[model samples]
Each structure stands twice: as C-alpha cells, then as structure tokens.
Target: MGGGVLGTMHAWQAVLRGHEVIHLEREPEARGASVRNFGLVWVSGRADGEELETALRARELWAGLGERVPGLGFRANGSLTVLRTEAELAVAEVFAAGPDAAARGTRLVDPAEARTVNPALRGAFLGALWCERDAAVEPRVAQPALRAHLAATGRYTWLPGREVREVDARGVRDDHGDHHHADVVLLCTGAALSGLVREIAGPVPVRRVRLQMMQTEPLDEPLTTSVADGDSLRYYPAYRGVELDALNANQPQPAVAAEHAMQLLMVQRADGGLTVGDTHGYDEPFPFDVVEEPYQHLRQVAEAILGRPLPPVRRRWAGVYAQCRDTGQVVHRQRVADNAWLVTGPGGRGMTCSPAIAERTVEEIGL
Candidate 1:
C-alpha cells in the first residue's frame, strides 16, 4: 500500500465509504510524480471512450472534493493549447470539429480571444484550443491537506516512513517487522516496482518514463489558465487527427525539442510562480543527472510564448512514473492476491484520473 496520490486516493475512497483506513508511506511524504507534476486535473487530452470518460468523472470528483478540502486550492482555470503556426492551427481546427469536441468542452479561439482568456499570454500565437474542463490544485499541499481531513474523521491512521516489505491476503508487514491487519489490501505504489510489487506482478507490462521540470520565482503577472505549446499535439492522444498527421509530416519539432521529446506545459502556482516543464525519456537506466539542454529549450519556448523574460529559476527536478506499455489499457490493475490488488502504471494520467480510479476500485471490491 503506497502513499502517493494513487494510494491516498484509495484511502480516501475507503474512508468516505465509512471504512476504517490505515495509510502507509515509505517516506515522510510522497516524493514521486504525484507531487512533481503540474497539479493539473487535465481532462481534454485523454484518449477517447473509457479514458476520456474516466477523466471527466475524475474532474467532477475533484471539484467536489476541493470544496470539502479547501486547502486543495482547486481552481477551474481551464487551459489553452496555443498554436503558433498555420499547421498547428489547422490541427486544432480539425480536433475542434470532431464529433465529441463539444462534449469535451473544446473550442478553437482566435488569437485575440486567446489573449482575452489569459492576458499573461502576450505572445503572438495564431490561435488557441481551449478546454474549459481543465483545472488545477496546489500539489505541494494536496496530500497533507487530504490527510488532515481524513485524520479528523477519527477513523484514519497515517503511518509514514513505513515501507511495506511483505503483503498477504489478510494484511501487510512493514520493514520494521510490524504487522497490520485489514480486511482488504490495495497497493497503489506509484513507480516503485520492486520487492512485493515485482513478486506479485511478475515482469509487469509497464515501463518507466522520466521527465525534467523547473519552477520559476513569482511572476509579475498571473497565468490565469494552464498553457501548452503546439508541440503538445504529439504527446496527447486526443490530437490524433488527419490534420495532426499532416502537421507532423510537414512541420516537425525543433531539433532539441524532438531529441528530448519535449513539450511546454506551464501552470501558475498559488504563490504566483510558474511551473514549467518537460521532456520525456523512456529508455531504461535513466540518466542520473538532469540534462541542461531540455531546460534551456523550455525556457526559450516559454519566454517566446509569454513575450517576456521568465522569472529566475527557483527549482529544478526530475520525476519518473510507471506507464503501461500496452496502449489499450488505461492502467495496469490486477488482483495480485485473494484480497490484495495492485493498481499502478497510470502514466501521466495519475494526477488527472486517480480520484475516479479509486472510486471504481471501491465499487469493484464492494467496499
């Protein structure tokens, strides 16, 4: 039973259902992709059908939960995928014209309208694709806030710095040789795929993805909505249209961006700083050091979009998360034992869909 967003969500689901919960974490707090992310409850770019449905439901649940837990700092800020070139705008138009575009709350806006939506976006973009369903929260405080709420219920116990070494159908034992019993056991480990996780899910069809990101000092202006560049079209599945194919064929990403598999996703934090990212690395044996080239490219692209210099760099880091290699599966979930379940490999969808995933798990187990 991990204590990342996924694990916390599972615990929240059970506690909401009136089940006494015992949450365990290996570290003093979650220091994984959950907190390293943009704290984005992104709904528009999810793959269609089941994935999209899950994202939508999760978005709704997040809003409701945010109200209950005020410290989440949830805001329905929406998002803008700004298009700089005619080719990128063409792809956005095609995506906007799709059958489910309206259902996804997607619309194409002219440059003027894009600026109107987010004044901080002073760059001269051709246009932008807007997704009103997108939202954000304070990732740095989300876990502790949720835990505080759960603790108030007098039915939740948080055991931090406890690494689960052994798990059985009945319960689990931590590294300190302590055994805890529970009627049901759920393992929501984010990216740690060793020991019990490996023993149960042998040679899992999951791979790790590494990414680098950086945050800036407080900005002079506010980024009302999260932002993404045209390069994001290659990363998100929702843009897999004929126009996207043409755009990809005709206009490729810049050398440095392509080499690092980079995308520009920027969001403003509660402190008025901006969280910007990121580049993807999927090969095994990820580099021990974060490369500077990706960060340089990101800063250059971000400055161009803002039409101003970025704030001084405040923090830089890298995060890795498990992703299902099989594209068909939303996440790798399996019943590893009689009363034990392993739910991991949500990839980047973890932050966006964890709430709904946990809700489904509770229903499936009749908790």
Candidate 2:
C-alpha cells in the first residue's frame, strides 16, 4: 500500500464500486514520482496495441474525473512537439500519416499553424506534430483532491504515516503493531521494491528510472498547450519507423542531450509557471544529487522554442519512478497471495495511465 497517485486511484476505484476502503500510506503525504511529475495525462508517446489503448482509455477517465474533482486542474490543452529540423519533421510526417494518427488526435502542422494553436511559441520551427488528445493536471495536489472526493462517499478511510509491514490472505499488519484485516488487499507501492515487496513477491521485473526537472516563476504569457522539442521524437515510441531511424542516424541529439537522454517537455501550471524537464537514467545507485548540465540543456532548448527567456527557475529536483524493463508493458500487476495483489512499475505512464490501470486491476480482481 502507498499514497501516490496509484494508491489513490485504486482507492477511488474501490469506492466507486461502493466498497468500504481503508487506504494505508507510508508517508504523511505523497512525495514520490506521483507528486514530482509534470502532471501530464500524456497519450502521444504510448506504443501501439495495449499500451496505446490503455492511455486512450485513461484519457477518457481523467476527463470525467477532472470534472468531478476541480483541484485536478485538468486541461484539454493538447500538446505540440515542435520540430526544428527536416529530420524531425520527417518522423512527424510519417507518424501523422500513420493509420492510428486519427485515433491519437495527431496532425502535422506548419510553423504558422502550430503558432496559431499556441501563440507563445514565437520561436522558429519547421513544423510540429500536434496531438489533441494530450492533456494536463496539477500533479502535486491531484492525489489529495481525489482522496477528499472519495471520502465524501462515507466509505473511505485514509491512514497515512503508517506503513504496511506485512500482508497475508486475510489482511495487513502496520508498523504501528496494529492489525487491520480485510477481504482483499492491494499494494500500490511506487518504487520501493525491497523489504515487504521483495519478501512477499521476490524479484519483480521492475526497475527504477531517475529524471531531473525544474519549475520556473510565472511566465508573462500563457503556454496555451504543453510543448516538446524534437528530441522527444527519439524518446516516444509512435515515431519508430524507417523514417525515424533515418532521422536518428542523420540528426543525432546534441552531445549533452544524448549523454543525458534528455527531452524538453514543458507545461504551464495554474499559476503560469512552466514545468520543464527531463533526462533519463536507469543505472542503479542513482546519484543522490542533481546535475547542472541537464538543467542547462533544458533551459536552452525551452528558450529556443519560446524565443524568449524563461522566468526565473524557483525550484529544481530529481524523481525516480519504477518501470517495467520490457518497455512495452503498461504496468506490472501480480497476485502475490490468494487475496493480496502487488502492482507497480508504471514508469512515466504512471501519471497518464494510473486511472485505467486501477480500473483494470479492480475489474480483474473482481473487487
């Protein structure tokens, strides 16, 4: 059991089914990847088949949930992956013309057209891949907001500052020496795969991914929509093809970008500050510190796209999220016991796909 978005979403699902729910969290509040994310209900980069379908379904669920919970700060602002080079545009062209492009709300637009969709992008670019299905929410507050809504149903109990130390077919025992019995138990632990998780479900297929991000002071203008640099083409899956391969070979990312596996994905907050990031790292024993080179590269790419200076960066941080090493798997859900299930490893899709993941979990578990 955890207090991140995954845990909260599972709680929401059970409450929706009119079940009495007791939610246990290790922290007083969620402070993991769930809160430390871009708050994106991203659907543009999901791989085809199950992954894409899950993201689309989650997008629909998020829209409805956003309406119910105002603090979710959900916006159908869509996204524009700005392309500055012919190579990047080629990838977008292939993707936009692909069979599922229509389903993904994807389109290739000229610079003028892209600017019309998001006027803050005064910087020069060849074109952009517009994804109308992409959306945003305020990540930091989403969990608590959803929990509050669930509490109103009079069947939800939130017990934070308590960690579940043991689980069996009957129930769980917390670190406080208290025993809480239940008919079913779901562990939505985020990235903590040791101790209880390992003891109960040894050697899971998940790995941790570290990423760095920053939030700047409010910009004078609105971002209108989330924005991405062409480097994102190399990161997202839908762009894979002969054209993408050629683009990768012909126009490799800059030295700093390649070294960090960096991508520039920026979204505006309710207060107008821009959330910018991120670089990928998978090696174990992750650095306990944040590096400056990646931040410098992110600022450079973001400013280049906006044609203006970013507001002063007020904060910077790093987050580690669990991911399935298989890359194509949406999430890792396993029944560790007759009545207990262990679910984790959503990666970057945690925020985008948690709602649907929880829905599917409850359905499969017959909750």
Candidate 3:
C-alpha cells in the first residue's frame, strides 16, 4: 500500500519489460519520503570498486530516464564535500588517494580552488572533495513527470486510493473487494513491512527511520554545487573512512558541530532556493512523529556554519526510509506461495539505486 520510488520504479520497469502492470497507491497524492528527499541521484557514496559498478550504471540510467521523461527535474550541478578542519581534509585526501578516485571523479581541492568551482562558496571553508559525477533533481517536479510518463506508457494501469490487504498465491486483494491477478507480484511497500513478510524472507530486518529536513526561500545567489562538511564522512556510506563502531561511540557535541547534523546544503531551483539540513534518528519499532525542535537545532547549526541566520523557511517536513540492517540497499525475494513471489526493500538509495534494482527484479522474474 506504500507507493513511492520503489513501487513506481517497478511499475516503469514492468512496462519496459512488456509486462502489463497495475499500481495501487492508498494515498491521494504521492508525497512522502520518496518525493520529500534530497532528490540527489548520487553515486559518490557507492561502495568501493566492484560494489559501485552497478551504482555507476544507475547514474547513466537516471540521465536516460530524464530524456525519456521530460521535466524530470534532472540537474548536473555536481556535489562538493567541503572540509572545515584539518582532520576532514585528511579524510578527503584518503578518498582521492584511493584506487577508485579516477572513475568516481573525486579530487581534493584547496579553498580558493573550490571557490572557483562554486563562487557562492567564496571564503566559506578550508577545502572540499569534489565529485562531478553526482547530480540532483527537484522531487516535486520529477514525481509528476514520472506519473505522466507511466500514464502515457499504455502498459501501466494505476489504481490510486486503493489499498491492498492480502497477496495470496493467486492474486492481490484490495480493500474495495476486488482482486487483481498477475503472473508475478512485487511488494515495494516502504516502512510498512512487518509480520509474516519477514518470516517469508528469512529476516531482512526492516525498520522505519525518520530524517529531519528543511528548505529555504529563494536567495539572490544560489550555490552552483552541493556542499557538505567533512563530518559528513561519518554519516554517509560513500565516505569509507567512517567506521560504524567509531560513529556509534560518538554523539552530538555540546553545541552541535556541523558534523552531527551531517548536513548537505544544495542550491536548488531557478529561483535560488536552497534545501538543507538532514539528521537521522531511529526508535525501536517505528515512530512517524514530525517535530519542530529538530528544525530549531538545524537552524542553530546552519547559523554556526554560515555565520548568519538562515533565510525564511519555505517548506519543512520529515520522511521515513526503510532500512535493512547495514545493507547498502535491500532487495529481497519472498516465495509467498507456489511460484508467487514478493520483492522489496531498496531502502533510501531508491532514487539513485532504483533503476538497476528494478531491472534486476524484472530479470529475476524472467519477464
């Protein structure tokens, strides 16, 4: 019943494979973690070497999808991880000095050199690790474009506001007392995964994690590229220098160093608006609470980093991403009944990670 990037991407993949598909979404409008995200089609944080080969291919797929689905809000602004401390600089050096630096387009640059690439960052930080391969898109703009493409595909059959209750070996049962049958079935429900679903797939260990994010009004000069702090190394998977054990032992400091927020500021839209602030927090089961105090903390950190109060708030929200314990992205196969299957759990990387994941799922089904 939870339909977002994973669900939609699977729908698109079905059409590509010449399989007739029916997409059921319970929500009147598709607005949640899937659309309310950084919208970054990222490859920088991909696992090292062979692990990244698939992510690299998905990067190209996003570009091709943009062409096919015009107004998909694709941008090639690239991403820069700014280093404010000597320790941060050393970490960036390690990444640049690593074996995959060339193909990843990662380089260490001095402050002055970074300003040349993003003039808005003039006199802002000590240095940055630039990755030209990363890009972004406007989620608000892209979702509708995707919907329209699916509508035009003729291969797609969408049933909005319809919630699926059960999926037996034969077909899917909805709340409206109807059942839709298909040769194969895939479940892309995010955060709502539980019960026998886990029993069926061994244990993918799905959990709903909420991220606090904020947006700003248009500014006079927008940053040409995305910017993040060295502390981001601890939070993002791409920064291999961050060890899981090391981070769990560490916590937010007395005044909230820019690192604790793991903030990645990106100048977005033609109007000069910027989207910033992302903090990860999790509870035992799952909490969908959207609070304001986190934004207050976020603003404090932004002021500390920018040396000034942030611009007027434009939009504010919280979204949940389904995570499968320590996995890059969750892709599972559940043989619910004889020959019938359920596939899901792509996690937060669904945007940059979905193209390849959907292709793999379709291939697995031989459709």
**Candidate 3: which pairs clash?**
45-238, 330-345
Model 2 misplaced regions, further than 4 Å? none
Q: How many backbone collisions does model 1 have? A: 0
Arrange candidates by lDDT, highest first: which order?
A: 2, 1, 3
Alpha-carbon runs more than 4 Å astray in model 1:
none
**How would you encode candidate 3's per-residue C-alpha lDDT over 76-101 as one tens digit per residue?**
77888877766666667777878888
Which number leads on lDDT? 2
| Model 3 global lDDT (CA atoms, 0 to 1) | 0.70
List the global CA lDDT of all models: 0.91, 0.93, 0.70
Model 3 regions more than 4 Å off: 49-51, 195-203, 242-262, 265-267, 285-293, 300-309, 328-330, 338-340
- Looking at model 3, how many pairs of residues clash? 2
Return the TM-score for each candidate structure: 0.99, 0.99, 0.88
Worst 10 residues of 1 by lDDT: 326-335
The sequence of per-residue lDDT tens digits that candidate 2 reaches over residues 207-293 is 999999999999998899999999888898878889889988899888999988999999999999999999999898999999899
TM-score ranking, high to low = 2, 1, 3
> Which residue pairs clash in candidate 2?
none
